[model samples]
Target: PLIVDASSDFFSRKIDFSNIALFYGGVQKNAGISGLSCIFIRKDMLERSKNKQIPSMLNYLTHAENQSLFNTPPTFAIYMFNLEMDWLLNQGGLDKVHEKNSQKAAMLYECIDLSNGFYKGHADKKDRSLMNVSFNIAKNKDLEPLFVKEAEEAGMIGLKGHRILGGIRASIYNALNLDQVKTLCEFMKEFQGKYA
Candidate 1:
């Protein structure tokens, strides 16, 4: 029954913790691989679960009591998470990550805005996600598939938009560098010139 919205990039934005019982997310974005999930919980809230008698594997207290060394933990995953955390700390922590991600998203949005309605965005302007830039081709429904195809031909992968949203979605996750965004923007401009 815990409502956890671990959708957005953590470093790029803050989560309002007004009434939340727990905060949990996969470490793949700001941290590392998809196999690791990190959780943040209040100690007082944890005390309330003491009488629940959940299975040892499912109980946080069991893991805490054993210092997370209980029953052969995911060693490889934890190692990877440590490596990622070290790398993140070396890069000046989450602040630097946030700054870089913001820059990349801004660059793409600037290009889209300058397109003069040739590029259409899917998400609302205010609610648009910094991690995933979703948009579509304006007035050219046929160009959507071509855009996906040509982007792939240009050495860009994962440019295809999500199925439910349709159109084009550029997921500018933290792992994606600014140079990659520039490369994508160049391709976008080229595609716009050809199809728009």
Candidate 2:
């Protein structure tokens, strides 16, 4: 069966699920509060798990049969997901959400592009992600740690990059407002002035 793990960009925009067998993602990043995941599987796919020896928790058919109540669930997380859905609907659905996310990502990329070689984005312009904007201190690579520290001090946390690909990664999720992104871009400018 075809399975998709769209953990990062799950609810940011509308998806064409016409032929998708299964779509799943964590609620932490773009969907809702943490501690839960959302899944959408075709009924035909669930039939494949029926009469199988798989554990109840591992069997999609089991959960489908029990209406997703086969065991204790993350009730609070589900409630929050509902609330997030309400918010999304109030904001005019995924099209509006995608527009806001695109604006936020564009603002960040513009900051990186205009940094005069101080900040170098990791992704090419064509492949940049709306969820995470990653970059490095082009002038002095060693200053990334200090940049993270100072960014935290300035009340902008979670800018550190993954260990394997060391740099700055700013996650602009659905909950992050445009003003917060402006704050990040402002911080980038101020930080560059202080260290560049």
Candidate 3:
């Protein structure tokens, strides 16, 4: 069985694909829009892919042989991915990007952690997400509606939590620069002061 790394989870925290048999992630997660995915497979793993009889379209070796030009590619999406990669590299590669991501997550998480019962973080401290900071209002949970409403009114959007895990999910993706995170954090502080 090939070990798979779904880089969606802790990718921003750290990325070390060397030890994995396979790794994959969608650009939608951080790089760009949807309809694009990046995958990596070890050379030995590819050579040993047991199912040689599988159709070429379903074979990694075939794609590798053709440099992923086995068929028409998602040209536009790939272009966008390249642009994003260039931007990230220009900003000092993964090290600097990860540093900024960590800082942004920290700013938002700190706001949640220091709210003194006004905001309650969803994940455990050790398990908190660096990409999506999920949390909720402590006392008047009902005020979550008002909170989301006011946040939207204040020019911030996409803070509502999923239904399965209702609350707020501040997605601090790589594309979001530090200034944006600071604004969100500032809004969090102002909202807490007024409503908490």
Candidate 4:
């Protein structure tokens, strides 16, 4: 079965799922909520359970048959998801959202590219992610912690990268506006000027 995990890019753009048997993702990233996972399964695929011995709670067919109400749901999170959907619709849907996301990511990538080697991007240019921009100091790697500290002081929280990566990561999710991104770019410039 062709299953996909769209955790990062969910709702960021249009996806062609014609060949997918199951598409699922957590709503916390782009969908503006937590504690809920959205799943889409082809109807015919539900008939091919891995085992009939599987418990109802773990069975795809059980949940599908019950319309996703086999158990109690996170009511508040579901409501927030609905509100987020309305927001996306009000903003003219995924196409428009995708454009904004692309613009935001490009602005950050440009900052990294024009940093004069002060900042280096982790991903190759073409393989970069629109949702999260990961980068680090090009020369003084020791200053990464200080950078994250100063960024938080400037009211830009959560710029810390993953523990394994141990650098800077700015998550430019759907909720961030272009002006906010510009502010971050400005911060990057000022930070570079201070120490570069």
Candidate 5:
């Protein structure tokens, strides 16, 4: 299983991935850009696949041996990743970052949970995502699109649901601070009052 945890909560706040075969995630979530991906593979597992006929680009050794500079790497994205990492450390490392993320997610989840049948969260409370908050307004499908539109008009963008799971998705990533998250919670409340 590709344990895709962009929050990295397991390592920072909980358990470890010491036994996982591989893990990978795109740069856009909390990294630097959207196109680039950061991959991590177990050394022993990678060695076993050395004789396989996979493309060089897919070969884990090509990246590990070259230190992620194999071929025409996404230089700009890598730079941004470095810069963002430095920025996070300046703000007090993953502990602080995770704390802020938890607070942001809590605000939005509280807003949804307190909606009194007006809004419904996609995941069970225990399974909610810290990176993306997926939900619906009491399964009122029509309201989701309107919410997205009005939210865009109000200066917040990318608050759309997945294509197949059309609903509301408020993705409060590490880059979004507390004030912005509060604004989103406020917007959700206002939208609920107007429609739900």
Candidate 6:
């Protein structure tokens, strides 16, 4: 089983072929809400499960047999999934979504690099996530809250960093447009000018 944090748009990244079974995450950065999780499995693997007598709710075969209508699945969650899927399709499917995400992340990274140590990115440059642009302000112990406040004032919501890693984290999901990223980049420049 592959344990993935798909909630943060990890699916947009390149998939390694070694993965066999992909599990689900309940929150949405890509999936788009709470109480909903999506699982993807290889069809060949399902055939092997035929001999196992797993509980109906726990068995993939049972769920497939019932067409995922098994055991009173969350109705509202399914609706939201459909909505998100439609939006994704309208945006030209996953390829376009990944392209836009890559562009947005590159824009943010460019701004961060231009900050000349005033801005620092959290993820390793090689393994940096395209979805969550995690970073920190130089001397962030003083600049962190101000950066968040200024971002909020500039109409940039959710620019605050994760609690586990204090600093700023801009989650650039598919729903976030390039304009929003440009706005945030401009704000970052302004903040750096004032603080650096």
Predicted model with the maximum lDDT: 4
Preferred candidate (TM-score higher): 3 or 6: 3
lDDT comparing candidate 4 with the true structure: 0.93
Assess candidate 2 and give its TM-score to the true structure. Answer: 0.92
lDDT of 6 by residue, 58-176 (tens): 87777777878888888888888789878888888888888899999999999998888989888888988888888888655588888888878877788788989988999887788
Comparing 2 with 3 on lDDT, the higher-scoring candidate is 2
lDDT of 5: 0.80
> Clashes in each model (backbone N, CA, C under 3 Å)?
0, 0, 0, 0, 0, 0
At residue 117, give the lDDT of candidate 4.
95
Reference-based lDDT, each prediction: 0.80, 0.92, 0.82, 0.93, 0.80, 0.79
lDDT for each residue of candidate 5 in 1-196, tens digit (9 for 90 to 100): 4445443332222235676677776767776776677776888867866865888888888778898778888778888888978888887887888888899999999999999988899999989888788988785877888999999999999988988877888887788899999999999889988887
Which segments of candidate 6 are over 4 A away from where they belong? 10-18, 43-66
Q: Model 1: runs farther than 4 Å from truth?
A: 1-3, 11-20, 48-62
Q: Which ten residues in a row have the lowest lDDT in candidate 6?
A: 9-18
Per-residue lDDT, model 5, residue 180, is: 99
Model 6 vs. true fold: TM? 0.83
Badly placed stretches (over 4 Å) of model 3 are 1-14, 52-59
lDDT of 6 at 124: 80
Q: 1 or 3, which is superior by TM-score?
A: 3
Best by TM-score: 4
* Tens-digit lDDT string for candidate 2 (1-196): 5688889998998888987899999988987888999889998988887865898789888888899899999999999899999999998899999999999999999999999999999999999999989999999999999999998999988999977888999999999999999999999999999999
- For 70-142, candidate 3 gives per-residue lDDT tens digits of 9999989999888887887788887787889889888888888788889999889999777888888887889
Prediction RMSDs, each to the true structure: 2.6, 1.6, 2.4, 1.2, 2.5, 3.0
Model 1, residue 92: what's the lDDT?
77
TM-score: model 5 vs. ground truth: 0.89
Model 4 residue 163 CA deviation in Å: 1.5
TM-score of each candidate structure, all chains considered together: 0.85, 0.92, 0.87, 0.95, 0.89, 0.83
